[model samples]
Target: MHPTTTNEPPQTLLDLITDVLSLLLLSTITVQSFIGRWQVLRTKLTSLQSSLSSLSESPLWSQNPLLHTLLPSLLSTLQRLLALSRQCSSTSSLPGGKLLFQSDLDIASSSLSNHLHDLDLLLRSGVLHHSNAIILSHPGPGSDKEDLVFFIHDLFTRLQVGGVEFKRKALESLLQILNTDKKSASLVVKEGNIGYLTGLLDFNDQPLIREQAVSAVSILAASNDESRKIIFEEGGLGHLLRILETGSMPLKEKAAIAIEAITGDPDNGWAISAYGGVSVLIEACRCGSQATQTHAVGAIRNVAGVEDIKMALAEEGVVPVIIHLIVSGSSAAQEKAANTIAILASSGGYFRDLIIQEKGLQRLMHLIQDLSSSDTIEHVLRAISSLSVSDSTAQVLSSSTALIIHLGEFIKHGNMTLQKISASLLANLSISDRNKRAIASCMGSLVKLMESPKPVGLQEAGALALVSLLTARWNKKELVRDEKSLMKVVQMLDPKYELIDKKFPVMLVNALLSGRSSGCRKRLLDAGACQHLQKLAEMEVSGAKKALQRLSGISLKSMFSRTWRE
Candidate 1:
C-alpha cells in the first residue's frame, strides 16, 4: 500500500506547474484590462480640463449673445460628464456623485455669472440691443431656482449703466417681471435699483426707455415721503425738465406726468417751480405733437395753481401761447389749450379779456360746434363756463347765435355731465342783460326740456335759465306772454321729487331774496314764491341750511342797498 501511494504522488508535479501557470495568465489579463480603462478615464479627464481652461480664457464666454448660445450646451455637457464619472466611480465606492454634482453646479453657476458680467459690460459700453438683450437675459421656463435668483440680481445691478438700449431691456425685464410676479419687483427695489432708474433720466438717447422708466419712478415715488426725497435728490426734476426741453413728444409727455407725480403735493410745488420746471413745461406746450402739447398744457395748468408759478407763467406769455395752441391746434390740442386758458383766466383776472381778444372765444365756440366726443364737449363747456363769467366773454356769447344754439343742442344730449356743464355756462352768461335776452328767446324749448324725463341736472339747468330770464329787464317781456311757463317755475317750488324738492325751494328763496330786477322780485312774490321760501328755511339741513343763509344775506343786502339808493 505504501509503494502504490508513492507512485501516484510523483505523477502530480507536472500537472501542478501547469495549473499555477494558467492562474498567473488569468491575473495578468485582469490587470491589463483595468490599466486600459484607467488610461481611457485619465485621457477623458484631461480633455475635460483642457476644455474648461479654454472656456475660462475666452472673453466671448461672458458676452450675452455668445454666452446665451453657449451656456445650455456647456451645462448639458457638464451634466453628462458628471453622470458618466459617477457611474464609473460607483463600482470603486468613491465619493464621486456628490462631488461631481457640486463641482458641476459651482462651475455652471460661475460661468453664468461671468456671462452676465459680460452682458453688463456690453450694457455699460452701450453696444447691446435692448429688446434682444432682455430676451436673452430672462430665465428660461425650467431654470433652476438658484440660477434664476442670481440672474435677476445680476440684471438689476447692470441697470445702473447709462446706455439707453441697456435701460430699455432692463426696464422691459423689470416691467415683465413686475407683471408676472410682484415679489420680484419688490426684491429689485429693495436692492436699491431705484437709484439706477432715477439716474437714467440723464441719458441722451432712448426716449421710450425714459418713458418706461418714468412709470417705474412714479410707482417708487408713491411709496413714501422718504422715497420722494430720494427721487428729488437723484436729480429727477432737472432730468425731467431736460426731457421736456430736448426729448421727443412721447418722452416729453411721460416726463410731464412724472413731474406731476413729484410736484403733486402742495408742499412740493414751490420746490418744483424753483427748479425751473414751470418754464420748461411751458416751452413743452409749443411742441408739434398734439399729445405733447396737451400734456405740456396740462402740466402748465397744474403748475399755475401755485401763485408764484402763475405769475411766472403769465410773465412768460403762456396765455398767448395757450391761445395760439387752441386757435390753430387739433381738437385734443384745442381742448388742452382751452383748459390752460381757463386756469390762466381764473388765476389772472385780467387774462380773460386777453384770451377773448386773442379769438380764444371764437375758437372755443367752433370746438363746441364741431366736437362730437362727450369728453371734448365737457372740456369746452368748462372753458366756456370760466370765460362766460368775464364781461368780455358775455359780449362774445351775446353776439354768437351759433354758440347759443350749440349750447341748447348739448343740453338735449343724454349725458348728465354735459347737461350740467351746459346749464352752468348758461347761468354764467345770464349775468349780462343781452345774454338774458338771448337765453329768454330759447325759453319755449328750454321749458320743454325741463319737463323731459332726461335727468335732474337738466331740470336744474332749465330752472336756473328761467330764473335768469324772469329776472332780466328786457327778457321779462318775452316771458310775460307765457304765463303758464312762469307758473310752471312757481309750481317747481313745491319740492315733490328728491332733486326737485331739494333744489326748487332754494331757487325760489333766492329769487324772492334777490330777483334779477325789481319787477322780477314783484313777479316772484306775486307768484307766492316768498311762502315757498319761508317753508324751505324751516325744513332745510346741512347744504340746504347754508343755501337758506345765503338767501337771507342776499335779501338783507338788497333791502339795505334799495333803502340807500332811495
Candidate 2:
C-alpha cells in the first residue's frame, strides 16, 4: 500500500504548514525515482516547500488568516503530486500509460505553481508583518493609564504596518485617545510615530485615513512645543502643505489647524513659505469652507510674523483674500482674517497701503457691524488701528461716515480694551486736518474714557485724540458746548490727577485759549481750569506755564469784552 494518507484537517496554521512540508518532502523523495514526467513534480514540490518554510519562522503564523487559507491548498496540491509521482515510479511508461498519466502530472504541477504564486503574493503584501504585529500588540480593553500605554504602542504598530482597514481603525482609536488625554500626544511624538502619522497624509485613496491622520497631527501640534518642533523636523509641514493645496474641504481644515498651531512658534513661518504654501493658504481663505477659511487665515496670521513671508503674503494678494473673508466668511473666519490684516499691516506701510487698495476698510466695517463677540471686535479694531496708523490710510478711514460713528459707539459702549484701541484709532484718524470735525463728534465719549482711573494708555490716547480734534475750529466750539467733556479735559491737567502724559491736556488748554472764541475761554474759566493751570505752572510742567499765560490773556480779553458790553 502507498504510505497512508493523513486525512485529518489542520488544527492550526503551523500544523497545516507542517503537513504541507511533510507531503512535499515525501513527493520530492518519491519523484526522484521516477522518469521524465516526475521531474515536474520534483521541481514544483521544492518551490512549494521553500515558500512554506519562509513562513514557518514566525511563531504567530497560525494567527494569520491568509496563511490558514492558502496552506490547505498547498497540502492538497502536494498530495496530488505525490500520487502522480507514485504512478510514475511504479508503472512503466507504455505509450497509452504515458498519455494517461501525463495529463494528471501536468495538472498537479500547475496546481503547485498556482499555490506557490498565491503564497508569494501574500508574503510580498506585508500581510505577514501586519498579522504578526496585530497578534502581539493587540491592546486590552481597559483605558486606565497603564493600559493606555499598551494601547498607544499597539496602535502605533498598527499604524506603521497594517493594511488600510487596520490603519483606519487604529487612527480612530488614536484620535479618541489623543482627544481625551493630552499627555498621549507627547507619547506619540516621543515614540517617533509622527512620521507614520504624516505618511498617512499621502493616502489619497483613503480619505478617512488622511482625515484622521491630520486631525491627530493638529492635536499633537497644539499639545506642546516639543511635539511641534518634532513634527516640523519630521517633514510634517510638506504633508500639510500638500493637504492645503489639494485636499478636500475637511482635510484642508484640519491641515490648516495643524499649520496654525505649528506656526505659532514664529520660527516655522519661513518653512511654510519655502514650501510655496502662502498662495495655497490664500486660496483657502478665499474659497474654503467656513471652518477651513477660519483656520487657514489664522495660519496665515501666524506665518506673517516672519518678515520675508509677511512680504510674500502681501505680494500673493492676501489683502483681497482677507477682505473677501471679512465681507463674506463666518464670524470666526472674519475674526482671524481681520487679525491677519492687522499683523500684515503692522509690518510696514506697503502692506498697509495694500490693505487700503483692496477696499479692506469697507469690508472691515461690514464685519465690525455684524460682529457681536468682544474678542472678534477686538481683532477687527486692531486691524483698523493698524491701518489708521498710516497717514494715507487714515485719510481713507476719515471718509467712512459709518466707521466714524462706529468709533464713537465703541468708545461709549465697548469694554476697556475696545475703548483703548478705538480711542487710539480715532486719535490716528484725527491727525489729519480733514478728519478732525468728523471724529470730534466722539469728544464726549473720549472724555468719558479719559475719566477712567486706570489703564493710562486709554487715558493718554483719549487725551491725544481730543487734542487733535481741538485743532478744528468747529470742534473747539463743540468741546466747549459739552461742559462735561470740557470739565473732564480740564481735570486731566491737575497735578493731583497724576496723568502719565500731561502734555496733551496742556496742549488742549492752549488750543482753546489760542482760539479767537472768548466763549471757550469763558467756559474754561467756568470749568475751573485756572486753578489747575496755576498749579501746573508752579510745578514748571512743560507747556503748563505757556498754557497758563495764554489762559490769562484770554481771561483779560474776556473781562475787557464784559466791560465794553456793560
Most accurate candidate by lDDT: 2
lDDT of 2 at 557: 52
Q: After superposition, how far is residue 99 of candidate 1 from its true place, in Å?
A: 54
The window of 10 residues in a row where model 2 has the poorest summed lDDT is 1-10
Q: Which residue pairs come into collision in candidate 2?
A: none
Off by over 4 Å in 1: 1-152, 160-172, 175-192, 204-233, 248-257, 260-268, 428-462, 470-498, 501-566
The residue ranges of model 2 lying beyond 4 angstroms of the native Cα positions read 1-144, 161-165, 180-187, 190-192, 204-208, 365-368, 374-393, 430-441, 451-456, 471-491, 516-528, 553-566
Q: lDDT values of the candidates? A: 0.58, 0.73
| Cα lDDT tens digits for candidate 2, 347-438 | 87888778888887767777777788888889888887887777776777777777777877787788888988877877667445565676
In order of appearance, the predictions have TM-scores of 0.54, 0.67
RMSD of 1: 18.9
The window of 10 residues in a row where model 1 has the poorest summed lDDT is 1-10
